[model samples]
Target: MSQTAGVKPMAIAGRAVSERERCLGMTDAERAWRKQWLKDQVLASNEPVHVEELWRERTNPIRRFYRAPLDKIFSGLSGVLGAERAATYRYITGKLGLLALGILGIHYYFKYNGNDWTKKGGWRVLKSKPLVLPGQEGFPYKSDRKQPSDYAERGFKKAAI
Candidate 1:
């Protein structure tokens, strides 16, 4: 007794259609529900599917410059803050650090920022005083002078194991 002799072959005239197999498996009511679902909101949400120009116009280098360096810095900070695990100690410390920074910024904005300093027109560029060379008193005002000795130490020290 062969398998085809007992049951319908689940194939059309000569070629086997996969859609025919799926239709045969479901009742008419289920087929209508499945068709309605496939035509519903999720499919409609992605209409006119491919928009290459939309992405092309919005690819901004300036915005990426502002975000890129700091994105990695904070991305690592989330791991340092133990955000991956549930711990009361980590949450408390993280929030305390955030609170401290917020308070410090508020203090600076109130104390050094307002009224008497640089009147309502907003923060003016802080005019810097000319720097005088320590040993060269009469050597003229040159900005290209070499830096002092200790700051010029380029020596690399090997780790003491």
Candidate 2:
């Protein structure tokens, strides 16, 4: 039996489609071309694919600049630590570096966005007041003038008199 015999023709919009067109939701001709392309790439080159390089090429120049030159760093490590250990360390360090970058990015995002240090009255911009101990003063502590807000008020009042 022919190759087309095994593939059942499918109908779309009331028209019969060829087996190749029905397969994998693509025209059989395109699928064959894609299969051929993969064979060419795999057979032609022994070099492994660097998908991240392609991604970097598509990224903004500023973002590319911020990216650590890990390849150079890892290459040096490979020379000193050997290939296998370097690969392991690279994987570990890469994950940790990304995590740190993410945390710092989030921290700066909050710090600058809608929470400027000077614009929002510095560090004490929050609505909540700090907790005061039963005997400790509230704030505005001075050597000469003492105006305590809590239980410490009685002591200050006596000292003032």
Highest lDDT: which candidate? Answer: 2
lDDT of 2 by residue, 1-161 (tens): 76578898663322113555456386576667666655665643535655987887878988657545775788788989997798888779888999999999878765655433235433323344466656688554334434335332323434533
Clashing pairs in 1: none
Per-model CA lDDT versus the true structure = 0.56, 0.61
Question: How many clashes does each candidate structure show, in the order listed?
Answer: 0, 1
> Lowest summed lDDT over 10 consecutive residues: which window, candidate 2?
11-20
Residue-level lDDT of model 1, residues 34-91, one tens digit each, is: 6665555365554657585885576697865755554455556767766344244445
Candidate 2: segments with Cα more than 4 A from true spot: 1-72, 115-127, 139-161
| CA lDDT for candidate 2 | 0.61
Deviation in Å, model 2, residue 7 alpha carbon: 25
RMSD of model 1 against the true structure? 23.2
Span of 10 residues, lowest total lDDT, candidate 1: 150-159
Deviation from native of the Cα of residue 41 in model 1, angstroms = 10
